[model samples]
Target chain A: MTTITVATRPTEAPAGHRLRFMFADMITVTWRNLLALTRIPEALFFTTLQPIMFVLLFRYVFGGAIPIPGGIPYVDYMMPGIFVQAVMFGAVGTSVGLAEDLQKGLIERFRALPMARSAVLAGRTTADAVRNVFVVLIMTGVAFAVGFRINTTVVDYVLGAALLVAFAYSMSWGFAAIGLAAPNSETAQVMAFPILIPLTFASTAFVPIQALPGWLQVFARHQPVSVVINGARSLMVGGYYHSTSSLWYALLWIAALLIVLVPLGVWRYRKTS
Target chain B: MGANSSIAVDAHDLVKVFPRGHVRALDGVSLEVEAGTILGLLGPNGAGKTTAVRILSTIIGPDSGHATILGHDVVKEADTVRRIIGLAGQNAAVDDYLTGRENIRMVGRLSHMSWKSVGARADELLETFGLTDAGNRVLKTYSGGMRRRLDLAAALVAQPPILFLDEPTTGLDPQSRQDLWRVIEGLVAEGTTVLLTTQYLEEADRLARDIVVIDHGRVIAQGTPAQLKADLGTSVVSVTLADAGTAQRAAVLLAPLSAQPPLVEGATVDLTVDDGPKVAVEVLRSLDSAALSLAGLALREPSLDDVFLTLTGHKAEVANDGGTPA
Candidate 1:
């Protein structure tokens, strides 16, 4: 027969040790989510395939009709927006993942553990961000195949991609709150669609802000999604759409979202029944 | 009461109400579990058993009242309490996408075990749970019993002294349930204190050193299995008549033989008495004199099932759904 030992009395971890454990717990949880993602090939396939389909649909079907100002190629102008849109859509996975965990009782298990409470949400958002990175890389290859070119240096391109992923990560915290609040995965997806559709479509992800009506154009130009898309466009393409202010505005929005949503998500997680 | 250092889990007047339906899941419930023993929280479905376990395990804070694990407050010192307790909730609480080995290792890592210990412990747990062959396979491929075993194995990754099993064997087959019972008994033999919630009367009878019966979010009775059964009587003489009408007559005929009235369910009449063989002979003689033919007769000691029925006014196996919303 196998022998088991009784646990020793529990002692509180010191402050520095607690901090280190938090990071270690976050990494472990992150690895768990990513490992689950890899096992579900259909989920990965659909997430990446949806973006490629969007790229093909926009480049071949909508490219000729939509003209870019300053004679910039439509493919080049649209690719950056497509990259931002892909990651933004990918952020919804955070909501679905968290809701699924809650529904399947994994959240209860995690909450009962000695690990840091923030690790669950942090690990989830981080894993979704990593997935966004993979999706963006694949989109980059597809954009190149469709005659899209980066007019800027490799560093600028990388910066733009980083901005998109960071924005996606911040959005994930907001979706994390939604996921925890939702009762189940189906409802989480349903709740996310209304918020996501308006943000992506009303912004400059698919069309220019100038193409919209006057009243809508104001919102289109100033919205966080539009600001980030313009920031990415400025970094990668650098033409009429380029503005140094867009970068600052995008960073400001990301910071604001992270500040508000991180605590909000963690609070919702703590308050989850 | 002064601090009872030997109590592994102690709660005082716990109450919880789910805000959605305003269901009072737990109402002024209090219980304690002594270290190195199993306290079976026995109840029917939706009787707040899961809610009680949730509060004690630090999964959710009670609306009112407080609890402590190993003398540390569950709410104020949840992190400390978490370090010393493992909970296998009503659901498996395991990742369906991960392998059995990975699930154990993940929990070990989260429990803050060293990487080397995590690996060795994962192997040991898988072997102990009889999951060694399936350790490399993802959980999606496991059967219901394997998943439950893995869930329990994952819970023991840190070898927490206190364990809360909330209906751990609710839906398992007879074989699987017995296997789980043996495992739980082995753990307790090794000095692991367990707070087990179950609707299975036999489970409580076989595994629990003490029993607490809760219904409608309230504790109706509490004692050891024998004590609870003895509260009803020393023996249970069950007689199965040919029909419900005969059973009702048999109940009335046998009612005066014991302090408690006979429990009649359709064609079966069960009476609690101070003596088994003596009362059983009296019951058969009385039934025969009344000209009622007996289909079957059994004389045995009082069981938790009879205790639950006497206390709750319903059979223990009956599902009282939507009562507590647990």
Candidate 2:
């Protein structure tokens, strides 16, 4: 039998406490996610190692199979493209994690606590964005080791990094959306593949859209990946030819994603059914 | 309304309708827990117990109800309500990849405590739960009991005065469960007012000073365990299947225990009698004399099962775990 032992001390009566997510909450959530990632080395392998290997493989093996319109080595052409695709595909991991948490009812626990509703998603996205930075850096280093030199000035390099930063930020929203919406980890993975695989193959990552059939060329040119990659290539060429079209399209994609994702994430945040 | 402004938990017309308004998860439910009192909301699964817990805990907004914890409305002042209450849901809420100590520290940090305080509190809770030895172990490595205990400790990281625990000991082994029960009793002793929702009649019978029974979104009865059992009559004798023969043999052999015919469940037999334990012995002896193979037997007084069957028509069972009916 459970006995209710009454402690003699007067209870610490509650004041009119308004809930606030302290700075510590954000730090803790992010740190916890990082620690969790550390424990599961496999997540590290897929998010970091696989992308690094792909950048090398696609640059060497697949690069020779295709040619760039600018007459550069296909490695140079595809490296930027790989960067964008990896960020997009890596989102699947975030969604899968979200799905697992949902299945286990951890998200509901968070809602019940005093933490800010946005903090959970924000902390996760921020942690993941930090992770993406490492993935990009590793991939960049591998490209450099493979003799893919950038003829761009320091200013152009900074601009490219800035663009990558914004791209990663926007891409994280898309991934966060998938994570919050997909019902389970397996479903999330399945959903992510359709978005990532098609986005990769359809973009002008490996070759100039000119080589693609006239019908497929339209899609290749219009894809946000193609625009971002081209923008990056132009940036790499010492800012010689700047096309606002690619950057604008990338922004448009981000805006579109936020329009759909913010509400979805919020709905997922509050839903108990 | 109670004159005491310090009445910790106050809910009025706390109604919640789910599944597109088809089911009433909480129908005009109302409750008030004086500060520092451990009030147990007792009911079976699908009794709208968890639904009520979620609403009052601020996890879900009620459709047409008002709830307050420490003077904060659950809907209008949800953020404030959240600050005053800690909720441990039915499942283990710990992140399996993190160590138990890390999980506690993480929750403490989320409560906005200083790093030193959070760290100190983490160690304190770990010690309190007798988990100091296993604190560094990853949650997945811990047993079901350990995970559940960790969940309770996590909810306390914020140090909220009003705590809500929904079936906190559902799958724990007896010893681990006792350890958690001890922790909860200690919390209430230290002035924490808990709102516990549980199906374990023994739990409510022991820990709850006041028991509120809900079924189909409505509060059917509310009182102390003695009062409830006194009202419901006596406990029921239930026998589970030894192998896979179903509850037919038990039903046939224990027929005298029931006013009506013994219920032949898939793998168990259920019967209500004036003295369950005494009758169970007679039933077993009679069965053995008849050479009938016996499975497992349990002697329980008119439990929440009897209370449930008296109030509704059926007993609460595992098959109805997540099925919140209208």
Candidate 3:
């Protein structure tokens, strides 16, 4: 038999080219995740439906009962919070996706490849950010149908949506770490809900911080969710509720989360066995 | 390129102990695979076969010792090793949400193939693997064998010279297993070096040029299939008695017939001998004169099964406390 030559040479490129390859690898992984999301219609259906249900529950069920501090319309007061809540909930997909990949040995396959080590986590979070945008747009439409209006300029409204997505993207990194830590998708879901529940409900996402008991009010006002919700409220409504400080605090919270969770998620990804 | 390197895979005294369960998965295990040949890592469940593969593939590092693929360190030079090696683990790692073609292409892209070649290579692999018709269908709709085929195709997308197959056909049906064996043989003919771990003796005998028999994370025997069988003897004289007690007595009676002692397993006694027909006559006459009632008797060539039973004192499928299953 004729002997064939082995391809054992290292395929290392220049440092600049490697960086570009890393970005391309991340995009490829992101595209793969989005393609998977499209195939699972039920998952996307439930993700979109949950936010719409939250909008209706707060708009009609509790809108009349909870009076705003400044006599603002409850729909306007709650819509910004609803947008934040929707993206936060949508970010859970990042955890579930990563856990599933880990459980199914897809992560092992990716690890064996010559791709960038950070590509898997970065790609997953970016894909969830894209999904958050879609879910946020759908929630906005539902909010509009249910008597929610943007009192600010169209540019400010766009900025508000962008802020919500940024927050969602940062949360995706946090959830990505959880997903890597959990053994399976079910465990990831169970672990994520406990953290998400108090952060979204105990904050100003649905109810006014002043209406909460005094003991809970301090936490309800200062949490990241509340800060981002209030910032989105200022950007979208811009009345007595508007404050430049709220927007700055929201940006700072997003920056802090990214700074802490990005490396944490990548570290978790590498450490996952 | 190290294309002419004699030893495609060189591992030395590799040791690994998992923190969970404190399982010593690999205990001073070491083996080498020559270029352009297949080496079968033969073992039962939890014999550190998967652990060895994981370490060689650079998925995890050994607690001690070291391995190199074509002179590139598996741990320190992992990125370089990754460029030349492909791993298809026990589980089919292809995504259920993507099509067969799409899965191959995605792996190609991750392996750093140019976009132009990734698409063409994916299509070429799908066709070669007989998945061209089902290439467009999502993997959720594929059968177990199809998924296994696609998983292997994905691994080969970058044309890696060295391949690690960790029980690639463990759960496949008989026909699918044969099909995979044929594909593997074809690949080996083209000079792709393979390190295949298997619990199936027949699979190792059929595919590997050399086999390393491991038990409890240690190599007990290593040789070609023919040589291993020859070491047991030329032929085996098997006799089925009425009960376990009678079989034990018959083993003592027939122990002098062969150089090695008879192996008694419940109601059957097996004795390896140099001559088949001559040994068969002697065995029957001795048992008859001893008044031992024989249910059946047969003489056949010594298979790897006999070699394994002689060396390990147990069947290949019997699990021992070596480590967790892969």
Candidate 4:
């Protein structure tokens, strides 16, 4: 019989110590995923490339065809909307990443480890949130280059950027649910696009509420995406539509998205193999 | 070797009915691995081997019954169980985008090791798995064998007392499989209890101390590899008859000398008998006396294939270097 070697086996850490490790482990998972982003330049290139193309298409192609109220530059009005759309697209990456992990059996390995169960979702969402922040900063630079100037103070701009990032963070939880539900990365993209496309296009992100047909205008005005867009626009441009309630509505939608999607995502993650 | 030795891995009556198509992947399966010993769960594909490993490792919950690793319950004390057990699943779980070293370090950090220790351990494992040269290369650039080795290294980052390897060499070439087998042997020598699942009988024969043959979601036989092979107790005599009409009469003529009832397939009759050559000669003479011509006749030593054929009424799905039964 082989002699037992106490030194070879890992002793269990105490409960209190393990709780601290959970956060640390979550950060490690997040860092690993971010490192993956650096390695996959193609995915990042395509992701950012699509949004930049949208900005150029709307600026040169559609800008001449449309006019905003109060003689405001369309560039000024559309920048915030572009930022909102860019962050929303960034959130879809969370689901695709998570689904890809599941398909590759990486999640099964993680689940088998003693790390915090929340770390998988936490790390994925956090990584995607950081990516959203990066995307927003880059889009902001592009907007400026194309003559999109902020009419508000520096504090308002920072807060608007922060709000956009927070909204993307909230959206990550929803997409995390989709990722856990999808069987593979391709399926995750297919599943996300339908929901995301409608939520983004039917809102005021690209066009004013008046430009849409009356039936679509109702959706464009009241949707969460529209609320976030309005909140961001008012914060950046500071106009008649800039009300404190717009930010409150965006925050409320964020709270609702988290309260519902976080638990659903965690539940689905627990149920997956 | 004694009965008082601690059970490192204990599972009782595990049942898993998958939601999709309601396939009953596992039904009432149970086994035990004594401390510092290996238990090979051997079976054909879709025989509930992966399901059992997943349930034991807490990836999926069993429909009923329970399991424990290193005295911690797999379900109730899963966190503790996770702390003590390491698992390398069917698919290599290393991140394709990360370097081999980074993948190991990632798992080490997730296991709650300090950053310094994570780096140290990653280097140690990279050396041990012969991955030092490729340590800085991303996994997508690594060979299939290297990826699997890195995955196994990831599982060992914490040096858990018990390890589960689910078909570690499933898709590997023969040379890679041998390299992995050596690494596993090294780990076992360091006093780790292992539960390995594989379709290769030769793998179980080489590595397992005790073997459990499972089929159709249940354990069909259990013993040491030698014991399982020895229980067959005789060779198989297969006789191909020239007179198809006389095959049944030939089987009746050989019944008393055969250990089991003769099995007839097409024009051939297979009999399990002691003293295979003598039995083959006697059967040939008897069939000739009965005016039944013989097309071909042979007596062969029993192999694991015969053992599988006897237990499951079919051959194992894997292609293995067939070893003659002793």
Error of 3 at B175 (Å): 1.3
Off by over 4 Å in 2: A1-24, A237-264, A267-273, B1-6, B234-305, B318-326
Q: Which candidate number has the best lDDT?
A: 1
User: For each candidate, what is chain B's TM-score?
Assistant: 0.93, 0.77, 0.92, 0.85
For every model shown, the clashing-pair count is 0, 5, 0, 0
Model 4 per-residue lDDT tens digits across residues B1-326: 24534788889999999888889899899999988888999999899999999999988889998988876789999888888888997788889999999999988888787899889888888888888999999999998889888998889888888899998888788888888888888788878989999888778888999999999899999998877867875788988886656677778888887766776667878787768888878887787788888888888866665677778876677634322211
lDDT of 4 by residue, A45-163 (tens): 88888889989999999987887775688888788888888899899999999999989889989989888999999989999999888888888888888988878898999899999
**Which candidate model has the greater DockQ, 1 or 2?**
1
**Which candidate gets the maximum TM-score versus the true structure?**
1
Residue B288 of model 3 has an lDDT of 96
Across all candidates, the chain A TM-score values are: 0.96, 0.83, 0.95, 0.94
- Stretches > 4 Å off in candidate 1: A11-15, B1-3, B318-326
**Reference-based lDDT, residue A234, model 4:** 79
How far off is residue A87 in model 4, in Å?
Answer: 1.0
Ranking by lDDT: 1, 3, 4, 2
**TM-scores of all models?**
0.96, 0.82, 0.95, 0.91
